[model samples]
Target chain A: MSADFATCYPLKRGRAHEVCGPGATYFAATCCNFSDKPVLWVCPSWQQEMLNPEGFAAYCDPARLLLARAASQIDLLAVSEEALRSGTVGLVVTEIFEPLSLTHGRRLQLAAEAGRTTGLILMPEGMGSNATETRWRCTPLAAGGDSTLQCWELIKNKSGTFTDWVTRWDAAARRIIVVSKTGERPRVARTAG
Target chain B: MRARPVDAPFALTAKESNTDRIQCLNTRAERAGLSRGMTLSDARALRPDLITRPADTPGDAGFLRVLARWAGRYCPWVGLEDADGLVLDVTGSTHLFGGETGLIADMRVRLMRAGLETRIGLGDSRGAAWALAHFGEGVAPPQQPLQALAELPVAALRLDPKLGIGLERLGLRSIADLTATPRAPLARRFGNGLLLRLDQALGTQPEPVVPLADPPQYGVRLTLPDPIGLLEDVTAGTARLLAQLCDKLKTRNQGARVLQLTLRRVDQGSQQVELRLARPMNDPVSILPLFERGLSGVEAGYGIDQLRLSATRVEDLAPTQIASAIRQSQTEDVAALITRIGTRIGLENVQRMLPADSHIPERSFILAAAAFSEAAPNWPPRRARPLRLFPPEPVAGAGPVPPVRFRWRRMALRVAAQSGPERLAPEWWLEDENWRRGLRDYWRVETAQGRRLWMFHTPQQPGWYVQGEFA
Candidate 1:
């Protein structure tokens, strides 16, 4: 499962990855930027909130992302799992309000491994699972004017290691890059003019 | 249309004005003295165990057309007789079935085999056939059609009920009574419609039975040697049928837009499963799963002996276009996946965000059902848009400028950094209720506690609202 996506980044392909806390959806969308294949985003049908194409365009093409709304949590997971199992979608992202059980996480992991597709599980609160390839926490940082700057903490890397970085979406380059190193408490730091 | 044994009390009720009334009843209900136009509750009181179903009038019309096609085996010309009957012009074609008697015998046997009752009539004209089918019995001889029709009731002329009642009140109980009266007075009172009908019945005026246009049928049926009730067996049967139907469609270069699968049970009852395609699909590999999804958990009561798959709606799939679609097979696969997922959670639930031609943030993009839309290669040029945008939730803030501190989504925070009073004017031509406050000055505000929010203030209304978030 430790198929390196990027050398320094705490992420991998063909496995389950968890992104929690503030800006988790944005981080999930950012993760999809790595693949050119179409993304399947699974969410609850009742939710009125959705990704803004204008903002999502800065990271990944909104056109590439297919939104699947399921009426229930089980359906949401089932859709994500099925999409992952199909191996057709480049990335499968699911927004789960309930905690992902260990068995469900393993099944998703196996599904991702079998299909060779990247899986991003978004949650409001973090309960890092053993079956997860990596668990990360994303918090909104200083610059929120024109562009988004966020502090990303790699809480649980696959190799039992920890790494953290302040990142910002570089619009012209169309990629998120590390802005600076941050300790326990993140301080406001300007990365761009 | 499901087949019901004539012995079973079955009635199709229809909403008539204010009350549900029996539109059509089978022999069982009729034997119980339940008649058409009778209130359903009265019929229910007469026969408590009556199997009642609301009639689908349009569906019955469609079924009548199908019945006409079935009757085509007897004669070439088959025209619909109102809603519940069919008129077949078997003028010369009757010889193929040995004669009028033999043709009728064959029709009766076939319709009865299909669990339907038939009251057929062979006559010299369309009106004579219709009248005999409804009010009289046996074929009316062509040379003496008037003599046969004279005994029938006046209502059999297919005149409006009001006219029939008016004629009946005047002591014209039969066609014989109407003809015995003076033609000029009858013409003045009842008008020429009655005469036209009378003439058409007696073979004086021409009445053509215009046959229905037979469209290129894209259907395949497989009757099993052994009836199947298991889902696996049904799935296998569906796959075989799919392969055959796809081959049929492929040769004609047509793709099914809507498919209906009818599984006829041994007990004469039937169940139907329908699949609507997001795109025209000819491949069995792509279409089979959708059918499986549609057919899963469908009750196969008494085991299904016959499986008929018909493409109720089809679209042209030219060879060149199919070749091009295959070249972009990745998209083809995605479309297939969408159809599969759509079968589970509904097609409308799967969506793709498409950038619209609008400056309004909410109207800038639309979530269109992925199955119904083709994905664009790229979006419109990136603007400063929030990561998540929802309906503007009113915040406790005021004035044209961004408030120094405000509450949103139940969180209160002071504004740390503020950007833009980006004046976005409403589209004057389009009346939008939300935009009724008029010009809004948007501000990208960062809260002191580290939350990015897109807030707007209306100059005309003097109120602020939070519309979106960066995260």
Candidate 2:
């Protein structure tokens, strides 16, 4: 209900311009406050074998985040691939390592629209933007005091709005809080991690 | 004493004043043209020939009481009317034994074997039973007392002479004539006594016979032609009784959940073994082993004459299909196996975990016998959990993070990769003893040994512990 509750938003570059894209894309950010509508995030790599620290951390972070948000009727039924295909989850956040079929993307798009759930995809850095609501590229941000940091991003939002926005990250808290509200020149801060 | 053939003529002759004219036996023989209370020699001198025998009062009474008990087989409820009489209220049950005639015929045959002469009365009242036993000449007449007792004079009632004369003078020659008189006049003149005889004969006055107390709620009874001695023999005997009990369950369309096996040893002091089943079952094969296990080492002092197996707690058990096709068939069959194991280990030793409708892992279950437990419903919605869960291990830590180094099961490991601070707060309503340790931060940590395990560190206790390992 308040400004601090808006925890995270799409990362910005130079100006807080809108995002546009050609191919189907996904954008996701964490909620800062409680609402009746529960927040859902999905990762296709949830079942992936954790070969390294980064990969293992990737699996562990979402689980912990979901557990933290278990306060608001946590429904974990969507972890199954079948559940993802059915769009049973309110929000989907899948890491795209390989190319997905167009049919898969269309089904996901229709399901997300029908179920009123946001679809978020983590894509590789090389692929240029295609038809999508929003597209974002993020790298680790500079740290702030007390486990807080910020991220740089390149986005393709179809709305042609808020393309270049900074992503603030709190690593110790596993939280990403947003600073900019309006589409304007973005100011950034750096801190030692 | 030598036993007499049951069909032989047995007289129930009692002394009568009018019988003085005829020489027979006992006091009547002496009184008839003989000396008063004279010796048999004197009685023989008067008649030249007189029959004589000692009175068999106790023998007859004892035999009659036995017959009364046997009569109980006809109806669940039966009572002894008097010294030489039995009162059977075959009101609704006459048809069950194939009407009064067949029942009387059956009783006659059984009695003949026991050496008794009987006069059966099919009546609606005790008064009618007495009247028929003493006065009725035929086997069974109509149930109507007036028509059945009409030919018999008023003296047939066994009343005193003055009372008979009064009834005769009142033109009440038979019970029918007496009942025909107005109740008001009879009460005024003959008093309630005459009316009582009338009402009792016609089946209305509450002439309730004291019925024997109901047979024990459940009886374990046995019948064996050859008595048994060895423990194995006793088990076989018990098996037979268990079969009989299952037959009874089938007839009732029910099954017994709890059973009592009684061993009536020839040496006296009976032994009782109680076997409990997880669920009510009527099949003899399933129940026999339960008792047999108890009987395997039974010490029959001398021998057991009979065996009795009775169902204590019975319930309806319908047939069901065995599910050998299910994925969990192996686990399901383990229940019957456990019950067999219970035979050696004692039934109480067998225990199973039943899931309770709760989210908390430890509190979500109760222990019961697998045999008796109801099948559990599908698992609740939650993250993929290990089939096995250990008691919460105390971990050393304060803030939520995967420990860089932690010791578990006496082994210290450096976290090769760390995953979570999945904070799990204890449910406030549930009183968890470890709640004092505060919230838990669980992490899936992969060790250098390539064994991926789930571990948690308690923020309150300031320690790290391994909870489970991923396969």
Candidate 3:
């Protein structure tokens, strides 16, 4: 845990990254805010929870998102790979239930690199998947009242040193306000309603 | 030969009067001594190894219709003859295949090659053709319909079954026998059907062939000099056909939405690959690659001798004169990607969330099929909504308030920080379909596990329910 990777606020483009833990969707949705082109969000059909435009709009423009409900985990990966390889969309976030193999992860990495599109593989809190470029975990942190805090842990990085950041989601401002960084004293967010 | 070596008897059965009877039988089944009307059980008992399948009546009719369309390669005016036959009016079109005899031979060879044991007849009129094909010699002397029909059984004239039996009882079993007897008596007994049928067969009365409607067929076909079985060759053939078809579509100011590619093999049956586009496209460069993936699913089986591309769905695409800037290319790129992905998974599965003028979280947005819906200008500034919404699952909490700690999806979550009891009431018209009852108190709860879940409590239902996650 070093402060050297502090400026890695936006993940690298044209590569695949793994994001897990409770706030993974938050990180994935925020990734859409970094680019101007369309965003592709692919998930398996059985995952009944859908992106609410109201919540999604707080982080990324809901209009810029193209949601694909793939019939299965295999199709989920397939469609995300196709979307990434097409280079049309600025970003592709694939949500999966099962762990992807290292080879499949490598294939997706290559597809993203070939198309120069950013790809994020989103999974549930404990699910392990091959990390192609960077791996980050998001956990909801305790706060006293009326506001939410999150810890984004950059546990693995290929281009920079490992670092984690604490952030508060300011829904009204529709932005993520960084609260603290690695090795810093944690402080409560000024987000009381 | 593929169906049980072409030696073992096989029959197609249809249920009639609560029992399965043979509707059609192959020559092998006929040689094995099973008749068309025999009960399937009796046939199976007699020939224990006989194979039978329930005949699909509608499917058979569809197959016949396809054949009638295929028959257009020979004659333009082809009409359907019930579910089992095709009446092709090859009157002036016979010269294309050389002569009448050559045409008949050619048709017989092609039909037999396709494994269809067809019965074809040539005559001066429709009645003579039907009668000669069903009863007399397969061919008639030119302009000699009377000579050909004279020996046919009375049933061959398409007579009423009762009248045919009455004619049989009077020893007038043959058409000549009925004609020899005075027409006045036959007409009086048969209600003019006998003489009318006789005149039609004799070419004295004109019988028009009601041709099938040629619906603006945007189709192009390629007949290869030699059959090709490889996937690459099929793809190449598709490209050629696509260009030709796109040209046809362009002249009419239309674009193809659904395209069907049919590949007829050298030895076996044909395979069809259908591609449905997200938008109407008349350009071959854009449409050709869509066929690439679909064509791979086709098993060439033997070499493919013919490829036909036709558009089943077309939309009016008035010529675009605009040379759009950078935005159009990007929009077109996204649309192209949508089409590619949509074609694989269903087009309905790929969607764009369009904002709606509603306060209800679910009603605030609509998922429109990405291919069909225009992209709305990026979302307008709006109220905060949960990232993911769930169908309200009951939280195991007691009161009409956000619990200090609650269990959801079998996980114990301790609520550390929480936001409002934002009051939202059910629309009067939507009360019955409301997700929760009465005024809903909505809360944004942050769990000790770093979960940001959106929960609500119904005042009337007296229960706390988790509906979405913000993370």
Candidate 4:
């Protein structure tokens, strides 16, 4: 794949990606917003209440979004795999708490490849490792002005070098803006009034 | 059939408090001077060795249902007529078996082989069939139901036995005796129900048989020569039945929405597993895995002798266009996958989002069943809202303008930037407990910690509450 294709974040066709940490779900939604195709969102039943269409409507067409609430982690995985393999859907997104094993990840990758669809797995903060092509840890940062800032750290990248970036999502323009890069330094926690 | 000499006297009895009463007696027992409704104690006293077994009402009812299902082979419409009899409407099917006599003979032989003694009755109406089954010795001509039923006893009309006795005592022993009697006086003397039954049987009144369910349009059955207990055998049988069922569905241009698989055990018991699909489907490959999941829970105890696959719910299946290979595979794969997961976790859990007609954030959109409801139409432009919203949580800070700082979830957050004071009034016509706070102004506040919180000020209560978060 070209560097431009790899650089475009969220998820890509015929590949499996994982977004972890506190703002994983937000990042997953942002990824869905970028896709032109319809999205299949599978989540635990408890998390169903958090799916705000108003937030999604900023980037994604609400009419094109489909939701599947799974009763358990196992069902979540199964439904995600099924949705991924279903070529009718352009993107498959799942919120999971359990760690995805290598074999399971590989299976999802193969299904996505066969269907020519994208699979995005959203995991809670501090989940175990998996064999995904790339794993991004996303955390929401305090907003400075009109745009919302999110810290994305590529913790695992099989196809390239690991990297991190501070990006701001411009809700009005419906695009991401790259902020100034910091060289391997911890972020300063500031309070505003 | 030759009548054999009496070897042993036997009767089926039901326990009534402290005594057992004979429900029914065989020919040998009746010949040995026993009668139905006779106390078992009295019958035993009359004959020292009068054999008896407790009545199995539930077993008999279950067997009746089984027979009803079996009768489906002869005709699409079969209903239970009383406890021991079944009514079959073989209107168009009779010709397939060479006529009514042939069908009756075939049923008799099969039922006898199943160890069940049966009596059949064919008529133009349900009441006629019922009367003929119990009274008439041979098949009655369709044109002359009244003539065929005339000589039979008044009990053939299915009147209460007490009422039958009342008519008999009045010199109305046979149906012919009542045919000539005046209707009003006979009804007045014997109650209106007697006349109703007589009219229904004589075809003057309409009596329709409400079948258990509409006959399945597509079904396939497999009877093994020898019972097989292995799971493989069950799956293999299901595959075969599904193939046959799919072929039948294809001919009708229909697809099955719900499938039922019945595994009849060798012990006269059966196990039924039902699969509900997320979408209508006719392909056997896609249907096989769903049955596999259900078959794991089924106990094929003592081996299964028969496997029957039936499409319980069928709908029209539009012919598929010759699409690209990828598109076709994708459609098939998704449908199959949905069916598999839906069968495991239930189809209701699979949902799709649809826009509602309300402006309230909570009521703006609804989750609908994916299998039934369609996606919402073009959604109206939405204002900026939080990615994640929670039940309104109270904030300690209060102010007419945007709060400079606030404490929520025990976290002290300073407002770095404030955006809106968009005034919104509560919907007056609706009774919403959450909106009881009256008019409010919502502001988008960006905190120093990099969290964008959606906080609102309820002017009525003059309190600040954090409602949602912007990603």
Candidate 5:
């Protein structure tokens, strides 16, 4: 990637980015790293108890994270929309068990735009269809020593071509480092024409 | 006062138990030489176009309470004088309508228009005011309460009727006659109440009026001409009340934190729904929807005759800054969002993190209620901590040294890499059961299976346990 696109991942303000797989939370946390403002975490009430504040401190300040627990999936979506519309929050991350409909995604996008905030939806793997600007599937790889490796497949992008990248999440340093330019699978050789 | 027939003379009667009597007589009925408190049969003999109605004592009391609340517009301090009267403390408020005389006149006219007969009194003391309103000549506030009260009848002191008759038998037909007698004898004869009443009316003794609490600060009430039972009607009423309530809040520069909607049914029973906000707000548009959800639970059985919206909790609302358009919009949006979500879920469940003062990993941060607390502006610089921590789970591995392999949660994990043992001692000043192991040596271990686990070894117990995991 060139320097121009190095810092930016096509994640624009007022847009929704869908991250799926076991490493979704980690990827969403990394996306949240773009802004220094407060972030809203909207999830199910049961999920809230399992959330470890120490983990989020890696990407965003713990004090900057506000937790909103919803009793149901509908409430979760509503809370995310509300938080996105609230211009005060820089980022809104929602955990949904089911894929959001196109209308709901569009509404979230509009609200995010109006508030000048970003929204990240964390959903289960393979639940692909969404209105988000970009969708990435992340899978946690075996650790190489102390650092955890993750492979992200950019399955859909509204502004760019499909690509893949291998990255290392350094827990101690609390930073994400691109590990390789090639995709996770070995590159196929071709004869020169 | 006479409860006369509307058009013609009628033999009317009021029944209390078995003793039926002519409680009130009309002009023509009285002209037939009939008097009040006469037996119903005697009134029947006079002329028989008889009609009677039972006196509604509870209805009268309810009307009196309504009147008292209505009087709050005139003065914030209003008290019920009796079942039939309302007392308003218009000390400073009278000037708003011009003066005491003007205020009284205005109130009289308004009450008359509302189909109520009213008499107002003003005095330096409550006792003096009560005496003047009930017994003295209908005059302006007296310059000298004692002199003005001296000419009134003895009953004007608000004495028991039997006591008044006894005083009259003793030649004390008027207050002047009672005042002329020696104080000691008067007290001994009529009991101490007479002198106390006299002193209180004369302004020598204190007679403080316990004014009713000011009407709900952000409340607006609407009494319908006809009862409504439909949900839409209730919502419409709520919207109307919210607009009025918001206007009141705007004037006072305050916002409601909790609101209560009372629906008074025609059956004389009332149902109330309370809505709590995550943030204080005065905007009616945002407030109405919250009431909409709460309205579902309110039973509008029969039909609702009155709807009252009251802000039970209020806080001073500071003006929003317009310096930075973007910042202002964001702040307002966030606040509004918080309020809306809070109403739907609950305010207590919304939480924000605050940095706590402690070196212990678990004690380093605490979750505080978002509505009551503010985010800690300066959190301590980040240190290496696991992404997730669970209650210490025992690991089937032993040693002061790193274990080559371990079994946790039915999974076998071979340690591929390991970090140092960061020693942390128990906080001596505090008693924690989890920390009873005295001291712990923590290690960051990366397993071959890609899981990074935080394991701790308590030297005293000689066992290793997985305490947290890094995402």
Candidate 6:
């Protein structure tokens, strides 16, 4: 009767520190490019240029669909900003990981409360954010063996509590097991009082 | 040669004894004991020297059969009737060889020079001609056997001894007697067997004569007047035959995929040479040269008198209409070129590698025919691969980072520059040799001069080997 927290919070205590924040729900969108955040790569780098947010949302190429189908923890989207504004998705994972204004955060908080599907925005390295449920970070780890994969992580949960954990990733089985345990921290409100 | 008995010239006369003295004897001499060759007195004493020369009956028959084949050229329905006569049905084609009489004279003149004596008989039926040829005295008027054979003796009918005896016993020795008798009385007395033969000889009955069919389908057969001994001559003969056969195929709107050449030697044996084409083609020039290479290795012992070229497998000749803008170089028809090469070298020699669903490089490709080139596209997308791949080479290190030095073959090299622990798990569903050994973590390690190698360390086997290297 409880939701799958592991699937919902795959970036907890990981190198994806800026995206995961202190909140009951979160949303983010990670694409091949972080600089062009709202502009999801609907086509390959060789295709026509990005027109507008609506135009980009309509672009559904096979390669993007293939990647979308592979996503285990979250549902992939073409327009994360629209999903957040319309309260369609609980969490909008955007490629943009910049600090949001109070107004933007309020809109996202309202949308996340409305939709059940939380969005996790995948940001590139060195990107930071001010408003999020958690700021968990992730990096490719050394492979344990032929079948086992390790990913470096940092978890920033809803309580604004931070911890580090080495998660073993089984790509074949699509399961992530925690290897090195980190300190447990108290939960905190993500939105400003 | 000088002495012989007056009654019996010779006790035994072989085929060619001294016959000069016997020839000097007067005419109307008895053949007494002159067997074959005998002295004059010996032959005369026995009985007398009989006039004898040589028996050329068989030689005469052979000559007549040749003339029959020549006559067959006109009507194509000519058969030698016994040893001395030919029966030709000039019904439809008599005008081609002139009229019936002209044709007969022409045949006779040709036979005369070939050292043969003959008689001419023309009739509406074979039996009439046969009877007239034997007993008509001179060139008889063309007649139906019933009328022209009236005066001819029973012997002239060429009836077997049993039938002749039966007729003679009945006092109906001549055909005339048989004709006068009523059909019912004849049937009741002697049965109707005699009537059947009479009707057959008169062309009133249907007798099925089986003709030999040309054995292979797409064949061209050539018969030379004189046997050829030279290889060049044989080659030329083969070329002519191939050309003719190709023409036949072209009109049929088909092309040959395989060809078989039969060289019939004069010594009663034949040689068959076959060649396969990668693609179907009917052009003799393209196919002839292909087989000529194969013929070079054949031992044409004495000589060849006949050459036959036949197409074994044929395909519909769909002439491809190339767009005018498309390049019209010789290389445009790759199938034709491949076929030519395949013919000269061997079809098995031209092979292509096709991709299968396997991570293992060795297991990835399956050898296929060059004709199946369409099955394979540019393979192995640009990924760093080894120049060669052995089984996984054993590595000492167990942790994440690859071993600095590992033994491959007998040579050991320190890792100069390495990338990747790209893990490719063996498909468990597929029973693979590598799967039984466990999974592999592949690494692209480069030696000196960008000599990149793909090395995999088996987790189960706990070893590694160079799998492949990129070019």
What residue runs in model 1 are displaced by over 4 Å at the alpha carbon? Answer: A1-5, A8-10, A127-130, A182-193, B1-213, B300-302, B321-326
- TM for every model, in the order presented, reads 0.66, 0.38, 0.64, 0.62, 0.60, 0.37
Indicate the docking level reached by candidate 3. Answer: acceptable
Put down candidate 5 lDDT per residue, B102-193, tens digits, no spaces: 87788889977775555666777777777778776344345577666777888888889899999989888877787788999888887899
> What's candidate 2's DockQ score?
0.02
Model 3 TM-score (B-chain only): 0.54
Please give the clash total of every predicted structure, in order.
0, 30, 4, 5, 3, 84
Candidate 1 lDDT score at position B170? 96
Best by lDDT: 1
- Clashing pairs for predicted structure model 1, backbone only: none
The residue-by-residue lDDT of candidate 3 on B222-293, one tens digit each, is 999999988887878888888888888888899888888888988858888888888888888887777777
- Candidate 1's docking class is acceptable
Q: Look at candidate 4 and give me any clashing residue pairs.
A: A141-B450, A142-B449, A142-B450, A142-B451, A143-B450
> Who is ahead in lDDT, 1 or 2?
1
TM-score of the second chain in candidate 2: 0.50
Q: Which ten residues in a row have the lowest lDDT in candidate 1 chain B?
A: B1-10
Fraction of real interface contacts that model 4 preserves: 0.73
- For candidate 5, give the lDDT: 0.77
Best candidate according to TM-score = 1
- Positional deviation of B101 in candidate 1, in angstroms? 23
lDDT of 4 by residue, B1-471 (tens): 113323588788998777899987777888889988899989999988887778898988997888788788998778887777777778889889889889889888987776555667787777787877777755768867877888889999888899988888999988889988999898777788988898888778888766777544677899999999888888998999999999988887888999999999999899999998877888888789878789999887889999998898998877777766566675466556667768766888777778777867777778787776666767777788888777778887667777787787777888888888888787788999999888879888988877788888998988888788888
- lDDT tens string, model 6, A30-50? 221222112211111121211
Share of native C-alpha contacts between chains A and B (below 8 angstroms) recovered by candidate 3: 0.85
The list of candidate 4 runs beyond 4 A from truth reads A1-13, A33-37, A85-88, A98-117, A141-144, A170-193, B1-216, B230-232, B318-333
> Which ranking of candidates, highest TM-score first?
1, 3, 4, 5, 2, 6
Candidate structures ordered by lDDT, highest first: 1, 3, 4, 5, 2, 6
